[model samples]
Target: MSARWRLAPGERAVWLTATTLFLLVTAAWLEHQITWYLAVDQFGYLTFAHDLLAGRVYHEWAPFQWLARTIPPRTDALAQAYVYDHGRLYCRYSPGFPILLASWIGLLGDDAAHYLNLTLFLVLLSVLIAVQWRLLRSRWRALAGTVPIVVLPTSVYLWALTPTREVAAHLSAFTGLFLLLRAGGRGLAPWRTAIAGVALGYAASVRPDAILYLVPATLLVAVHLRRRRSPFGVVARIGVVGAIGVVVGLLPALAYNWTATGNPFRSTQGMELDQFLAPLPRSEPTPAGGAVGYPSPGWHGGTTSDVQGGGLRLANLPRTLPANLAFLIEAYTPALLAAVVWGGVVALMVRPLVFVTAVPYGIVALLLYSCWPRPDPRYLIGVNLLLPMLLVEGTVGTLDLVRRLAWRGRVEAARRLAFVAAAGMVLALVGAFALRPSTSFGRLAVPILLIAAGGAGMAATWPSRRVVAIVAPLLALTLTGIAVARAWDGLDRRAGFQRPQMLRARDTFRRAVEPRAIVITTEDIGRPAENIEYYSGVAHALYLTDLARWHGSVFGVALLAIQAGVRPYLLLPVSDPERPKILKQLAGVFSLETVRDIPPAQAVEYFVAAPFHRGVHLLLERITWPGFEKEKQGGPPG
Candidate 1:
């Protein structure tokens, strides 16, 4: 009897539930408790979600906004009321992930959104694993295939958080790849092809770079068809499916561009230019010494260079790309590097198809990392997912080849040596697991058992049933256990209330100020920093620097927006170096008052200095220099 059949129904159900619960608990724990500091980009997402809950719609460049806007209304009266009154959402990211978040928030409220996101991520991850199992046709091999993904440190980090566009994009991309492989030369059933196409489209929508995958994927499909000497009908079907997917995926971005910027291809570049470009006025000479202006030119759009002759020039490519790559490597934990090397080595040796699929994605990831100014680790998360799948699949295929040779009696000695080597490798892996920074030595007992099971499977001397019996449950337990343990460790160390202090600060400022607060700050202090519109319940503007004399165009926009009553609260912080000039500019516009210095103990507290708020109130006080005094009843700086 099969092991699956031998297990009691209740026992099987309990096992399945335990595995699932382990994944869920681990994901929740990591997202909520992990000690790794949250990046500013995450705050940007939270702020965007928060703003979507409010009725403000000005910041619509992000694609995630559309998703947030489409959240379904709930039966709960309070949720319904909140949605009806304040849900004018807009986003710069693709609509897929935010839509998912909105749906969860609608169903269970904000408290459950993160957990729901983690659940969705795990479900998709399982689907990818199942796809590999189906392709390999061996349960043991499938389990091995999934191991790298579940245990990779960065993968663990991503699994335990809110859904990012990159996460959705990777899931969609993998699903599309799986469908394509399943449909190869069989000529996909119309509905299946359409569904696959839609999935691919969604992936592309999440990341424009995913568009590169469509061409390669289509060529791969076409190559398979040509090899079969299939009729023109096959070509037509593939073309139609590919075209439909690309168009569907690109539609949201196209529509957004048309509505916002009058060009279908105009991306966040236009919005950034309008909001963060446009030069700042020259700083008047200070009474103390030399005049202070904005620092060296800041980044615009995806380009990391300054605006030249009223447009951004891509001059910093030499300096930017390497820095971005270095940052990307640092952001991913060491496990990722190990996986990449492992995948590369295995791919070169066996299962070349897996290698082919991985290479294009890796190249694309590299290009984006190299060129893009932002060094966000999240951008490369998809690579983490792909490399592990390839590594495991390749390893299993190579082991299977060895087993075939041994069975044929052509290489018995070689097979024996291979088995011994594999056993030693497993022991080493167990030792590595024990040495892992987060894992407890005591908890590694199960992993050691799993390594032994893998060694038994590698030996291939026993009946296949005995091998399956020993290996299947052990592999499952290992994958499930690692996922659970990592999740638990992550949740145990979450920043909790301290992390949400920024949100609280924004709320406080909003309550204290009037409806239209003319907030002014450096460009970096905008959305991710203050999330002013979300927490403050006020319309605000960016202060951009003038490009010719200064590079802080976003800061100038803040001042201009304030002057135009688009902003009402003068929410300037104490960190602006040209605070006197900023104060002088504001003196002409409205009443200037130092409502509050964040640390309270410091005399000349600036907004920038607020982020440096460790236990250094004394240091801040020592460096505090009072310069900007409220111009008593003045209309302009004279």
Candidate 2:
């Protein structure tokens, strides 16, 4: 607390700026509640967090059960379902994020757990910003000029709220970078390197992919050592110490995986393997008295819980790369390419060491993501965070360049010219804002104007090369305002599209069934099952593939339900081409009938508006199993 007050005004502003952004995000959350942005990964994390709190490491069954009066809709339809290991069920995800989130959930309760999770993140983020703030002030006081840039781009705020491990990854990676930069300047003490390594390793624990950050750091160190003509023994010793720290940090994850899946290297997400390319289906036998006939053979595929036979292949990478690249660039439009361009320039001119240490990681990240089968924007978040730092460095480098040029003569002429150019740019942006057609473009225009104002102000004050001090905060405020507007709009959009449908579905389900009744459905993904199980103690839910030995069939779902001493009920697409065959297959084995019609809840529709929404509306609507009966009848469908 004392240390906080000791901060200089600019440093304190950094803290306050982060705190303000955090508050705005939290306010959005309070208004939207936990259901907003409910992805499958989040359900797993929340469920796993609960499991951890309850003293269980592996979940053999779904955890929720409630009187069938109602069940919340699981919004994360694509989240991975539980995987079977030699007949035992366990979550197929890395446990790092959940393990960290568990203590917070226990402390805050289910409803407020997310708020607490994010609040804790704010505290950590503030610290990270403070450290970086101090570092920037020391190395380049001109960096204060770029302080406003911390408002970040709008996408960043959106990502911060999502359930994915990226936020934790960002935190860990940033903290590690801060530590590493500090260690680099402070004589690279053994403990400092080890701690930085450990911090990076923790980032990996949160999201395994973060280990890539170390690749550049290591290269940078080697280059620095080479440049300094360090002894081989010293380099070897440093490498060994760092390696030991990373391993020690990663041990918990390794042990957790080995215990859960018998393979420490195998992440439950199974993302490395193309999920869409699963093995060919083969006939297998079902359990005795099982409605269908054979036990389903488990196989790893893409991220989906249901067995899938096809997907975007590696050959598709060439085609996918362009759109992904465009989206990636658009996503980081806030910082522009200042970090990327200037970061390189600054490294070459001021700190060649940073180029050696951190730039390679960015390069590797680019290559790795570009080649990835699926090009999700979330994967590049860490790189986005790094971009601003680069931008700051670049801004400072520009100032230094100007100072050098000024010393060579012609200072007054350059200053006058800069002022004229800056004023012209400001006028152009204001004119463009007035002429903008759409609200989206209009939203961006305001920030563009602010950026121009920063430039103009810097020019007017001429001879002051540190434009960052003038531009950074103004730009930060501009982006922050835009981010706030987007957050509200995004939250509202989510509520309009998914929230109502989900609440209605849950209410419908509660009214449709009695308490303690088992639900057997084709929708066996983690989110649905977890939601049902959370509300109801009967965690017995199975995917269609969970029943038959053959892949991609709903036949086995009925069989498993029968064997569990409960009548089977399925939630399936009524109009699907496979529906007729599926019903025929169950004809003599179990009676089938529609309990209720679940209207279309395609997430795409909500996001895409009007005509586009209709495209998927026809495809995703589903129907449930027959009405619940107190007693099971041995007869076929009537």
Candidate 3:
């Protein structure tokens, strides 16, 4: 008979309380949002989700969309990412996330939809515990693996606030990989491998780049499949089954593409956004007022245009990798580099099987994001998911190595290494919290010092490595909190972190226009048309215009839309010198009226420009041609 460990009543209560507090913390970050702006990705996904619930293909074919297709001043990165194909307009985000979101919206109300982050995260943690329990068969070990994610300040908080595909993708990929781990390596569990393939395939559909993690995952699975002296035919059969499962999982995305573009092989998103392989030019500082009336290249740093090559180049791994490692260090630990390296080496030498299964996901995530042009802190969220497991595995592997060494009569050397490991923790803390880690040197030095700090103080009364397994994380959490706080100031400066003061401002602007009115925004206060549509029953397309060079032609198209029975309103910045000239041009064509002044929304909107950290005001003027309305006349605005 075998016995299993169970928690005492008080221990159970403590665990419950700890879990509740972590949930509350996550909820609070969701409410505050820490720092982020509503981008095209969020709205695009939501629109697709809405379309799915309407019982039609996830695309639109309105007359305004025709205008959008024909419009000149369209910025693919700036406005809602819509691709026009086969007479239907589709939001260019993949349908997998939207399908998941639609299901959530259908089951629960829209208000409860955000809870997907929390709920899916809970499922992921549950699955992680199950995987660890399966491997070690110890409740304490399972809890140890799960605790960092629950207790530490990881990148998951940054993701949970946004209505993107992150948490779902994370859950899907992690679930897939760990399920394979749960299957004993020596056994032939075809069902588990098939299901894992399905999950990973679904993950790839949701976030196409997520498929990169599968390379390492596949290697791990292949190693396990061959662990036993099985015939080649058996392993080949299992692999074929998994391959079939991947195809089955991809059917939904393929079906969606077929419905939207009349081709199963090509997605509407791929139609417009196939230029990622081509590198983008870094933004040079345009003067406060460029020759054009544009507001200094505008704000919103969500995609490639914002800071694609800010300091790191995707092709140059040497420079790019270190910068990314610095970022991960700032996120989790200054000791991250040391701990991960030491862990990987020890796990490889001592427990190659565990190393292949567990460590590769984090390694893949790191290398994958290193190649990403977007340097946003949120890029490492997936890596954060693996850290707890990696730390646990690494610690166990290191201990195992030390035990082996001691068995070989190297007790003194092992003890000396343990003392230095404790010293490394001290140096990591000092470098993280006490110093200004602005320079690359400062950032990389902390982890390097962790290895060779021979003279670092070690008190006789100090707790053992067993005690540090708890204390070090609590310290790392503090370091992460400080690092994130420091990074927030830069993110706010660089990323489009804003107050929903724009919402209140939009509320005032929406009251003056009908749902059918198309708002022309030259000012980048926001692309508010989507949110406007969300609140109202519908919203006409927001036709964005070039700064000063192309307004004449754009306004001509606006007049054409007016002739086609579309009401047009020009949303301009009050401080823009081009506003008066724009109004005068419009007045020559039609009777234009000032609707209201859009109050300055408290926000920090920079297009990789120097941060203003303040709000910009907007002037809303309605362009109405009574001749077009009463007499059906239109050439210019008049």
Task: Give me the candidate number with maximum lDDT.
Answer: 3
Best by TM-score: 3
Better of 1 and 3 by lDDT: 3
Local distance difference test, candidate 3: 0.55
Off by over 4 Å in 3: 1-17, 28-37, 61-80, 129-154, 183-188, 261-263, 271-297, 300-322, 392-397, 407-409, 427-434, 437-510, 543-554, 601-614, 630-638
Q: By TM-score, is 1 or 2 better?
A: 2
- Which should have the higher lDDT, number 2 or number 3? 3
lDDT for each candidate structure: 0.46, 0.50, 0.55
Clashes in predicted model 2: 33
Question: For residues 209-306, could you state the per-residue lDDT of candidate 1 as single tens digits?
Answer: 67656654665566557666778976787678767876776776667545434577765333333423333324412111110011112221211223
What would the per-residue lDDT of candidate 2 be over residues 1-638, giving only the tens digit for each residue?
A: 23422447786577466447645664564345333324346666777778888898766452122211121122112124445444344665567778777876677666554454455445444545554454444322222322222244324434444345667776776666556554323456667678877877888887777889788667655755776677888888778888888877677678778886578876555444553344322532221111000111222123333332233335435644675666544543423343356557766666665455446776677666655444555666656555555655544434444444455686775476456545644665555546523333345444544564456456446654645454555554555556555555656543332345544545555665544444544331212433444433433343343333224245444444444444445544445455577678766545655555544554222121122123222222222333322234544433
Quote each prediction's TM-score: 0.66, 0.71, 0.77
Q: Report the number of clashing residue pairs per model.
A: 51, 33, 4
Writing each residue's lDDT as its tens digit, candidate 3 over 474-564 gives 3333333433344344432322333444344355545667666766664355445444444434345453432132223446656776766
Q: Which stretches of candidate 1 lie over 4 Å from their true place?
A: 1-15, 30-116, 138-150, 159-163, 181-187, 219-229, 261-356, 373-375, 394-397, 413-473, 497-507, 523-530, 539-576, 580-591, 600-638
